[model samples]
Structures are given as C-alpha cells and as structure tokens.
Target chain A: MGRIYLGVDGGGTGCRAAFWDTEGRRLGTGLAGPANLTTDFDAGIANVRAAIAAAARDAGLSDDDARGAVCHAGLAGVQSPQTAARAAAALPCTRARVDEDRGIVIAGALGPQGDGTVLAIGTGSFAGRRQDGAVRSVGGWGLRLGDCASGAWLGRAALSATLEAADGMRDPSPLTDALLARMGGTPQGLVAFAATAQPADLGALAPEVMRAAADGDATARGIVAEGAAWMERALAALGHAADDPLCLTGGLGPLYRAALDRDGRRFVPPLGTPLDGALILARAYAEG
Target chain B: MGRIYLGVDGGGTGCRAAFWDTEGRRLGTGLAGPANLTTDFDAGIANVRAAIAAAARDAGLSDDDARGAVCHAGLAGVQSPQTAARAAAALPCTRARVDEDRGIVIAGALGPQGDGTVLAIGTGSFAGRRQDGAVRSVGGWGLRLGDCASGAWLGRAALSATLEAADGMRDPSPLTDALLARMGGTPQGLVAFAATAQPADLGALAPEVMRAAADGDATARGIVAEGAAWMERALAALGHAADDPLCLTGGLGPLYRAALDRDGRRFVPPLGTPLDGALILARAYAEG
Candidate 1:
C-alpha cells in the first residue's frame, strides 16, 4: 500500500529491475532474459514484465501493489516516441514511463542531477547531455546513415578499407589481409556478407579492428584514429566543454575511453549503472 | 534463315536489339522500354521480347526465324551466374547466352577482338576486360559494400563528409553547406534520407557533387579526387598497361575519363555499342 518504485533497464544482453520504497532505500532486484524490443517485441515486453514481478516478489510487495507501483523503464530499440508510449501502456505498473535505454545512462553515469555528457557507442552511437533537468541528444541515426564512432560503424569502415585495399586504392596491410582471409579471401565474400549484414553483424568485427590497432597495424590504427576523431567531433558538437565530466558506456566504450583519454580527454567514471539510473528516475518521478 | 545474329542490350533506361546476317551485315535495329531484368523481371522480359520482334520485322524475318537466331544479351542486374542462366532460359531465342551488362561495354568500347580494360562507374561500378576471347572483371560489389568510384559511392562519400562536417570532424566547406541545406539543413535529415535510400537515390546526388568539384568546392574536390583515385587503382588492379586500350563507360564514366585523362590515361572510344557486343557474342557462339 505504501509508495514503491520500480526501475527497469533492458538491452540486448538482458534485463535488470530494481525495486525501492519511498524512502529511496533499495528493496530488491531481479534479472531476466534478453529484451531487445525492436528485434523481439513480445519476448522483450514479456521479459520486462517478468523481471518486474520477480523484483516485486523479492521486495515482499503484493502483486497488486507491484502493479500499482510507479515505474520507469529504459529499454533498447525504443526508436520512436510511439514505441515509448506503447511500452508504457504495456507495462504492469499503473504509473509507468518508457524511454530509450540511452536516457537512463546519463542519470546512471552522471548521477540523477548531474550536468555533464555521456557517449554510448556500441552497435550504435549517440551523444547525450543532461543540463538544467533537460536532455538533448545527437547522432543515433543508425549505421546506414550515421552512428559515427560506433562498433558497427567501425566494423563497416574496416571492411570498406579491406575492399579498398583489395582494389589497390588503399595500401594492403596485415589487418586488411587478415580480414580478406576471413571474408573468404575475395571481395565477393565480403560483398555476400554485406548484402545481408545487420548492425550487430557488422559490429562483431569492431573488436578485431581495435585489437589490431592496439598492436600497431597501420590500417587498423587508421580506422581507430578515424573513429576516435569522430568521437571527439561528436563530443564537441554536443557542446561538451573541456572540463565537462564525460562518461563513456557500452561494449566499446572502454576502448574509446582510453583513446580519448590518451588524446587529452579528461573523463569521469560513472557513478552507477543504467539500472541505478532507472531506479533514480523511478523515485524522482514518483516523488514528483 | 541460314545464319542470323541477334544482339540484345538491356539496361534500366531501355533495351536495344541489333540483328545481323552471317557476313556481319546489319539487318536492322529496334528500341524498347527499360529492360533492367533485376528490378522488373516481367517487364524487362516483355520489353526484350518486344524489341527483338521489332528488329525481326525491320529485318524482314519471321518471328520463328528471329527466335531461332543465335542470340546474346548483355543486361543490367545480372549479379549472379544463376540470374544469367535464368535470363538465358527465359529469352525467346533458341541459342542464347546471358551476361552482365558490364561485359558488353568492353566489347562495345574496345571492339570484339580488342584487348583492353574498361571502368564503368554509374549508379553501380565495375572494372572489366576482354582478352583472347576471355573476359575478367572486378569491383562490381554494389553501393552497400564496394562500388568503388560509382555515382552511388560518390554521393555516399559526399553525404558522409557532410555529416562529418556537421560533427566537426571534417572542415565544413561550400559543398557540405550546400548538401546540408539541400538535405533539410540537418544531419538528421540526411540520416532520414539514407534510412530508405536505394543505390539510385544515392547516385542521384553524384551530379551535384561532381558539379561542385568542377566549381572548385574543396569537399566536392576531395570526393571526386578520391573517386578518380579509385578508378586508377581499379584499372591498375585489372592489369591495365600503359598502352592498354582503356575505355571509361557509364553515367559517371566521362567525368572520370576527364580526370583519368588529365592524370595521363589514354582512353579509347567505343568501337560499337553494347548491342554490337551482343551481336558479336551471338556470332561467336553460333559459329563454333
């Protein structure tokens, strides 16, 4: 019967939910299966509901109380406002808000009221800033158009460079040679793969490029440098100040963090995880 | 009725058929609507049939005679051997061979027995050569993967440069400014366009980029120079010798020819049309 808050963060990997009472003390948490809404809406929504239920059970709240709880969810594949609104309508909680998983990273990494920036670059890329309780973002345009500095973008660039090398436009290198070998030793092989490759499929190659760059492969180094340059440009375009507290997140986040730091970018470590940000949002919304 | 050759050249724009007798005397020629077999297979086939019928009528040959004549078709969108086979099977001709449109460009430009190289950079790109009755090719990978020096590739690179400029990674220039303005004055607008753009849609922008380059726009110049460089590399990769009969063909072909010629490339003019190449192939196949 008392005020309760539910915070849910869902991505391709899995879903996490945190429950807390009105006093801002955590009651319990629950984990669930992968919940990428865009790829599998039914499964994602189901997993989301299941995670909330488990969190409620762990918190000793009745099913009805849990359903009545104020909730906030940050999920992957929430591309449009319609998706967000639909997700909110689908949730069990009576008072619920749904948002792209990215938004929560800002609060999670920079604290609920922090004024700084966050760069989330994995299979996709975007830069965000929360200032004066307002949030603005740039560059979540997906791999086909943009998503510069993202894992998918990096992978695509590497593959492109490999093909260019094969065509003698670029100097062949160890990385290009290795990539060519892996892609069936011909440009056709890469072409066949690219014909049906999704963003994640492309992003799958980012680690290799990064690893090769670390080992001083000229081609890989150039790729990484270009990605790093894009990141810097993104930050600047986001109006990031030299002294702003920057937090990098996502799978390729750490690699870029190092690159940016080495390039004189002074970044601050995240205060918490996205789940924490969700919980913070849940509490803030309920309290308001 | 003794021996007649039918050469069909089918593309996105239109289809042409040339009919010839044993001594290589031209019988007649016919034109029809767009016959790009890949995009509109039924229409393409219908148009091809219609064109051949018209040519037969012009040559004073019966439909049966035309169908029995040895035939060769060079068509756009013949990406695979299977498509070629399928096209060959579907044509009305009794003895027919099907090949990608690019192949015929070599014969058309270099003559039936001419040993030479050809670089065709239109909405898509490919480099090809015919020597000693054998044809070899490279770099027809398409816009998504590797259409080096193609119009689509140029447009994509220009758009990418525009986005990079918007992000502060690349220096903003007149070309980028004009592109941004034309594309709704925002990176998001470009992203929106790219989200659903086909190769042709992207290639549609190539003319503007080329024009800008011709007018001394720095970003446009860089894009064109890059495309020109790819042309050189592709020619070299295809084993083009200093004295090889190089022919530049396609919508963007002349633009690149100018660039390549300025860069010391000596290109030969087409000795015939794709229809001629097809007719030549028909004769070769039937005689043997």
Candidate 2:
C-alpha cells in the first residue's frame, strides 16, 4: 500500500485536516470545530481525529488507510514540551508529530529552503523566522499577554477607543458609533459584550475596523497604525533584515500590508497553506 | 419593631454586610463569598442574603427581623439600570436600593456632601466625583475594556512585560523572573496560567508587582508608572481640579499614591468603609 500523509492545522477557532498521497498530490480536506489544546485537550484530540477521519472518507479511503496514515499536526496551545508530548500521544495515527502552529505557518509561507520571516496575524498573531534549518518565533502569546497586531488586539483596541470616545476621552467618530450600535447601541451594551467575549469573538470585529480604516475613520486608522507598529516590532524581534523576504499570512495579514513600513524589504507571497506544511512533515515521517 | 438598616458591600471577591440601628449604632457584620451581579446573579443574591442572615444572627435578631430590615447594596457589575433593578428585586430586604459598587466607594471615601474625586483601585478600578448631590464617574469599564490602574491590569501588564523580556523584545528583570517563577518558571507556564485566570486571580499578583517596584525592579516600576499614568488620564477625564480633594481607596489604591502626581491636590483619608456608605444609604431610605 502507498503511504498516506495527513496534515492538521488546529487552532483556537477551528481545525482543518488535509490528506495526500506519497506523490504529494492532494486527496481530500476536512474541517471541524475549535481545537486549542490548552483550552480543551480532550476536545482538541477528538476534533483532530474527526477531521482526519472526515478527510479519509472524502478521499474514498478505508478506515485502515486512515489509521495507517502518518500525521503532522501544527496546533495552537502546544507551547511546552509536556503539552507537545501529550498531544502527540493523543493522536489516533500510529506515527504522529505535534508542534506549535507557528512552525507550520512559517513553513507554509517560506517553504524548505526559504530564508526570512512570516508574520501571521489572524485570530491570534505570531512572527516566525527560519535560519540555519531552525525556526524561531516571537509573540504568539495568545490573546491575553500578547498576540500584538492580531485581529483580537485590533478589535479590542477599537472597542476601547470607542468607549473612550463615548466618554469624551477622545474625539467621537462614525466608526465608534457604528461599533457601539452593533454592540446594542450603548456603551453599557459594549461593556456587556466585552465581558464574555473570547479572542475569536473579538477577532470577528477586525474586518469592520479595517472597513472603517479604508473609509478614513480616524479611530480605525489609528488602530490599524498601532497594529502595524506592533507587527513591525515583532518582525524586528524575529531578526528580519532590511532586505529579508517577509510573507504576511492569516485573515488580517493582507490588510496590514499598506500600513506596514516595508522599506528595503521584500514582501513575498506564501508558498502554500499551513496544511501544506503539515503535509510536508507527514510525508517526511511516512518516508522514514 | 425598631427600624433596622442593613448595608451590603458586594464585590467580586466577597460580600460584607453591616447591620446598624436607625441612629447609626453598629449592631453586627458578616462576610460571605463573591457577589458580583453580572458574573453570577443568583450567587450574588444568595451571598447577600446569607451575609445579612449571618449579620442578624450575630446581632441576636430573628429571621423575621432580618427579612423586615431595610437594606442598601453596592455591588460590582450592576452596570445598567436593568441589572440594577433586577438586583434590587432579588434582594431579601423590605426596602433595597442597588447601585454600582463605585457609588458606595465614593460615598465611603468622600462622604455624602464632601466634594472632590475618589479613585477606587481594587480587583477593579473606577474613579468617581461627587458634586451637588450627583456622582459622575469614569473608567470602570471592567477588566477587558478599561479599569486602567486596576490590580488586574497591573498583573496582566507584568505578565506581558515578562513575556517580552523572555522573548528578548525587552530587558529581563528580577520582577519578571519572580513572576515567571510563580507561574511554573517558564513563558509557556505563564501562557497556561493566563488562559484561565479570572480578574480576582490576576489581581492577586498586584502586590508582588508593588513589592518589586519598591525593591527597584525596572519592569515593575514601568508597570507601576503605566498604571499611574492611566490613573492620571482617568482623573483628568473625571475633571479633577488641582484643588479638588482626592481620596484613594481599595486594596491597590494606596500603592498608587506615591506614583501619582498629586499636582497640588489635597489627598484626604476615606471617611469610612463601603459598608459605612451602604449603611448611610439605608438610613436615608429608612427615614424617607
């Protein structure tokens, strides 16, 4: 039987799995609910398994074929060695490797021999650099302590600025009024919404901020600029040189391109999706 | 039956109930668990009731006497009029007035007629000013939106700065090291801790930051300065004048005094505790 490779990108919001043949041809893909290991380890494992099974089914593969597949999962919340080991052990595949989601993001953006950095700004944000066959990352500290320049941060900043405007701390803007209206048309409503909002919930508002920024709203423009500044700081921390190739990935990444100071730097396109990077790892494991 | 007044200071950490006669003589006091209305309405109501029951028991009063007592409750998370009305209705008192916890704090610190500002910096932070029988407030937007100089904000800032130091984005300090050590001695550990940390849990770390600041830790000092700056912004927004009397209250309030720029303002001592304020309100209600 030919070797089957499975790649999984498990994040706080959802999980996606891709299946491929030994020849590097894509077979099928599947998606499931959130799979952040730290938030819910059991649910994460279950979702990963479910995604793999669904991918196999979509590819017309038997149950045995799915079980025999070699898997590489780039998962959120795999921060520590213990968590990585635990996640690896929990996978249904006989041969599976678990790593931080940022690694797959870097690989998918830059490929095997590519040098430079990738700044991923999605529901969460992280910057990764590949040098000397090793990957180093900065700022994927989740929504609380870090994830600066992330969609979550952008939305949070907008909400806070809107409240400030409401309280006359800052100039009122159409953007703030629109945001408040969406949050039940009152500052108290926004406060209520913020109390129970998760990272993804906040990130969902990022597109609105971007829309307002594009329309020249001062508060929105300020938020986007601040986020871009944080991204620049992250890129610098990742040791990106002036001429280094950089790729911005994730949902809110492209929105930041114009805002970022790209002087003397090359903003390259991503080689593939994180799923592709996961597949590459899976294939390597299957070959061995 | 004599007119009995009950005052309840309900907070995120715990609820305190003080019983007094109409003439303002203290009868008894009781303590119970957290009673933040928004977080858990039923639990808050139950705790308030339990605290009152205990207070009456300590004062050698019957259940009927406690049930007939006029009460005033100052609770956390009574942000909107609807929540306040709901809370008032749920209270086990003949005549109850429910208000935002900050009002009681202002009353306790400045007295009913004392004009000026009060900065309450506990697990949550809020600034309020009393003028002409009305109270105006700013920056009690909770842990997510505002609460700038709050203990929760302080702990969160320390954790974030510690992570930046760990990532080489900033210089490491003893304060960060000690904080990291408490959270399993690693950045990963800190991330894990942050995922599930509630406001009160984060607020618990504020004293450590204060201690480190006093010991001359640069990171700790930065966090303190930032908090003080936020307080200043909040105070300014509250329209505090140079001559206005300002009183700082709450667990982390006094720690901020040395960091704050008084700018020729009179810093006064709190007239009484929140319980005292609640009792005063209860007396007013009873008299009317």
Which is the leading candidate under lDDT? 2
Task: In candidate 1, list every pair of residues with a backbone clash.
Answer: B109-B270
Model 2, range A124-213, lDDT digits (tens) per residue? 888889987678988888778998888889899999998877776678788898887888877788898888898888999999999899
Here, model 1's chain A TM-score works out at 0.90
On TM-score, the candidate that comes out on top is 2
Model 1 chain B is weakest, by summed lDDT over 10 consecutive residues, at: B256-265
User: What ranges in model 2 sit over 4 Å off?
Assistant: A1-5, A19-23, A28-34, A53-71, A82-95, A283-288, B1-4, B57-70, B89-94, B286-288
lDDT of 1 by residue, A1-288 (tens): 578888999988789998887786889888899887777888999999889888887888887888877899999878678888988999988999999887788788888786898988889888888878888777776787678889998888899888878766678998899989999987767777887898899999999988998898999888888888878777777788888778888788878765787554568878888898998888787768
How close is each model in CA RMSD to the real structure?
A: 4.2, 2.9
TM-score of chain A of each: 0.90, 0.93
lDDT of 1 by residue, B1-288 (tens): 578899999988789998898888999988999887667787888898889888988999887888888998998777678888888898888899988887677777777685888887788888887777688777776777678778888888899888877756578988899889988887767876887788889999999888888888899888888888877777777677787778877788878765677555577776877788887778778877
